[model samples]
Target: MKSLKLDYLKSLKWADYLFFALVEPRRLSGKIADAASKPLGGGIAIALCAVFSDILAASLLAVNTRFFYYKITYGFLLLSIIAFVKVLVTAGLIDMLCQFMGYPGAVRTMIVLILYSLFPQMFLLPLAYVFKVISFAPPFFYVLFSIALFVWSALIVITGISETHSVPFSKASLMFIFPYAFITLTGFLASLLALASVFGYFASI
Candidate 1:
């Protein structure tokens, strides 16, 4: 029983993973790649924790006068389901992009790496509360802090992709960005086309 407990404790080194993911991402990426064949429970747990932090931060920001337990509970459940789906879809998109870029990687590896990259986002919850406590804290500072966290997470994911795909960091970075860039460009062009169609119809009238 004692041995089992020790092993269990050793297995839950998520804290260390989070630390290294933020500070030593390239090294942590190698470790994550090595453990990619293991059960996905740990990676899922990390993703859930990161997602919960984001939800909790938004909940804190939404609190105006009173704190309602049921609202948070229901919101968490609904948002968690949405977030999980988004992660899976994103992993698929990223994997497809990687393959298109000639750096084919496993979907499972992408999922694990993405989840580990989110480790830095877990701090957003506490930072939100801190900003809330300080009445004079500027909104600019909060925005900067949020942007910094996102950039940090992006770098970690980029590094993981480079390590796992055995590709140049530049290529990995482009691979990491291609999906979102493509989506944004598509959306922009679609909006412009819709606007032009509307104008053409009005002109015909």
Candidate 2:
């Protein structure tokens, strides 16, 4: 455990990683991919911090509500667990897709890139607190900013994939989006089938 902690601390160059991720994701991804011998300590740390920031930001929005304490406690735990699982699963799926496409990149590298991409979400906590204290802009500011942050992260991931796989930005975007699009379509079709079966049963009854 002590040795593991040392390794994690040594690899946790959070400032440099965050800077490169913001300005030059392609370069950052390359660095991460090259460091294959290192443990995934940096990636795991960043992912945890990012999830915590997002959950805390969301909880801050409920400050005026009676459930603020509840959200701060159990909501953070549940949401953090979900976010952690989502990061791992999504990384696995993306790496599998890359392998099937003949890229054969490491799943660990994918996880690192994905976690770095989520660095923008860390800003949400400050933004939420600022808005809560000032209310300078309209409510739509939150929606717009949220969408912008999402796009920022997506672009980072796309760029990272392009850098890792030596593909064009357009192809990289397709690679990043394909898994999610397929999942959404599958879920939609399944829901439609479920509804149809229910209606058929009601009609028979």
What lDDT tens digits, residue by residue, belong to model 2 across residues 66-178? 67776667877787788778778777878888889898767788788888888887777787778767876524556666788889999999998899889899998988887
Candidate 2's C-alpha lDDT? Answer: 0.78
TM-score of each: 0.78, 0.85
Off by over 4 Å in 2: 1-14
Report the number of backbone clashes for model 1.
Answer: 0
* 162: Cα error in model 2, Å: 0.3
lDDT (Cα atoms) of all candidates against the true structure: 0.75, 0.78
| lDDT of each residue in 136-193, candidate 1, tens digit only | 4635445666788889989998887888888888988888787778778888999999
Model 1 residue runs over 4 Å out of place are: 1-6, 10-14, 63-71, 189-205
